[model samples]
Target: MSEEHNSRTAAPASAPEKVSLWQKFRRWPLIARIATFGCGGFLALFILAVVGGACLAIMDPEGTEERAQQAEDDRAEQEEQEEADRQAEEEAEREADEQRQAEAEREAEEEREREEAEAEAERLEGMAEVPGVEGMPADEARDALEDLGFSVDFETDTEGGVWDASNWVAVSTDPDSGELIEDDSDVVVNVTRPEDEEAEEEDDEELAQEEAEEEQSDFTITQEGGDGWSETTVEFDIADNFTMNMIRNGARRDTLEAIEEALEEHPDSTRIVIEGSFPMTDQYGNTEDSVILRVFYDRETVDQINFDNVMVRDTIWEIRDGGMIHPELQE
Candidate 1:
């Protein structure tokens, strides 16, 4: 027995051999091997992905969360900016539409005003028929004629043989009553003052003698030089209606009398030229001091006229620019 045991112990011990995974796989069936390999490869890739994610999280936990938050904030900001731009665009469009509407309204209003003005002008033109002014006061007659768009020229006969339009009564009018005339035609008004019978009787002899003398001393006017005449210029400020009337009644009368007296001394004088200018109304019917007047004639004839002999009732005539006289030809 002892010899049998020694023989068993003396036998060589042999280690168990390990089987390789490739050899195991090589022993599998074709379909089973393919499935097993696929499953094993999938499992290995998933394990590697989990390990990589864990490593990244451990390296930068705060940075990863910050990057995600920043990306979300950027998207929100972009959306807000886009919304603001849309609102601004809408506001601009609304303003532009309003401006266009306002412009159209203004243009329409102007067109309406123009049409109304035209209609008013037509109505006034059609109603400009002249009316009779006989037996009316001189001022009333003038106003009446002017209301019809007619210019008025006044003449008065007084007991003193002097023309005083301010205190005269209109007797007759040129072109007569009920005469159809142009809107801007001139109308001559003849006016005379009433004379008292007792006064006339008291001064009959003296008036007869004065009349005889005046008839003998009256100067004759003739156009011997083919309507040639002497010219003079007078400038004065016309502030209002009162001043205009004063000029017409006082200054114009004195100037004409002076001219007549001067012509009496010169028998060769043919005529006397007179012209006047005043402020013109603008588009708004406002007057300004831009009027001008000029008279042109023979210089030699004007030199003989004596302006100093004239008698002005209200205002005095003074030469402007040291008595400089500018002459121009009549159109």
Candidate 2:
């Protein structure tokens, strides 16, 4: 009975009960126990995270690669959106600039049109219609133009200008008849002497008598007798080169009578002469005189000549020779 009890006690000693993990932890010191619980918790969390990751990978094999591609695609789309916005901004700025340029051009065109209109209006203000002066006397034409607030300029067609403008007629006008001209503009009246109507009235007998009289003497005098007869005396001693030239140029007894009358008006005046000048244009664009005719007059014995019903061919001397001679007529 003693041996049986000893054996039972030895069996109980040899197999002291194995401590559980919780019992072992509880047996440690306070700090050690806390450290062991924390370590165990961290290890369990790590194992659970690894197992969850493996399970997700097994469910969708290409999930990580697809996520990476989606991220890359999103980044590319954001960049494209920024580029589009920039392009749109640039286009808007360009359109605005073009619109501004077009507006400026339109404004400039309007201003030019306005200026042109103003100029046209101003031009029309100072304008007038030129009056018809053709076939009118020079004085009448001058009066007509002056009445319309225009100055008159005279141009003569005949080589020997008229001594009096009233004796001439206007053939035409510069700027023409029935045309528009500026206010106070110069109107040029082209004048010419009227045709000699009496020249056509000379019959053949009168012409033959005139030829016979010219052939008779350079100068002639007639005296009437009491018996209805006339005595004619021809004087060749009074004939001079100048008088012969005057006769050759169609001057008659009336021309000498007219010169004599002019001399009678100014008996004290010396060196009476008739002069005619024509305008000539030089190579240097200068207007100059070309003397056409010249005739010297004498006062003595001029009244002895009869000049009834005759035509004078030239004008008498009006001014002195120095006043009448042009620079081109000088020696």
Candidate 3:
């Protein structure tokens, strides 16, 4: 009976109760409780995140790679767009520069054309009117025309009764008078001798005939005894005045007269040789010496002597073309 009573009183001590997490958390102080709650919330969030990531990975395993590839494609597209934009900007700039340069060139050409037109108008305005110089001395008329800024070219009119060019008078003009002409234009002046001088020429011709009649006696026969042939050689210097007269009048009157006189003196001669030389200046600023020799045969008669042989026909043509003619030939 005493042992039963002690066992009942000592009642068997129960196994120590285990403290749950929530029970221990509830037993903490206020600050420790807050901290424990915070830590617990953070741990719970971390576990949830881990579970959500695993679920996503299981649902679509390639989702991460797709997102990365989309990001890379976005970056590449952005770079390509930027490069295209840069090129377009550069092209626009280049086009703008070219347009500006073309505009400048066009403006420059227009300005040049305007200047040329203005200069031409001014030149035309300054042109002078040609004055009449008929019936004036040839030299005086030429001087007057030249003073008015004209290039004077003189011509002799034998049919208009011109004999000596030294005292000749201008008969007409090519462009007439009161015509507006540029300074570079050529003015041709026709000249003729005074009426009084023409009357004296007839008397001179009669005297020349008488002198020829007297000179006929001076011809002497040569005894070379070669087929009974007689030859005469004559040389004459081509005077500048004579050359000029021939170029202007188209006839060497003085030379012909001298030859006529020689032929009248030696009518029996069969062959006649003539030699001449003249110096002239060409248009190219070169000095040329012209030499000529011509032989004439009495094919018909002395009165109708025919030209047989000629040397340097080109030189004669050049002289006829007024290349070797004096500027004052038709004075």
The C-alpha TM-scores of every prediction are 0.30, 0.30, 0.30
lDDT (Cα) of model 2: 0.63
Q: Order the candidates by lDDT, highest first — what do you get?
A: 3, 2, 1
On residues 1-331, what C-alpha lDDT tens digit does candidate 1 reach at each position? 9999999999999999999989987999999989988999999999999998788788988887888899999999999999999999999999999999999999999999999999988766644556777768778888999888889888654445435555667778887878777788999888776553345566997899898988752323223344454333333332235554554454345334434554555545544433344566779999865534323334454555455664432222232112212222111
lDDT of 3 by residue, 1-331 (tens): 8999998999977899899988887888999988877999999999999999889888987996788799999999999999999999999999999999999999999999999999988977858778888778988888889897889877764554434445878878878888887876899988766774576688899999999998753223221214757665444555554455454333243334434555665666555544444566779989776543343434243444333323322233233311233344334
Across 171-225, the per-residue lDDT of candidate 2 in tens digits comes to 8889898888887899888887676423434666698999898865333332223
Runs in model 1 deviating more than 4 A are 1-54, 127-331
Looking at model 1, residue 234 earns an lDDT score of 30
Higher lDDT: candidate 1 or 2? 2
Worst 10 residues of 3 by lDDT: 314-323
lDDT for 30 (candidate 2): 100
Q: Each prediction's Cα lDDT score?
A: 0.62, 0.63, 0.65
Residue 86, model 2: Cα distance from true site in angstroms = 2.6
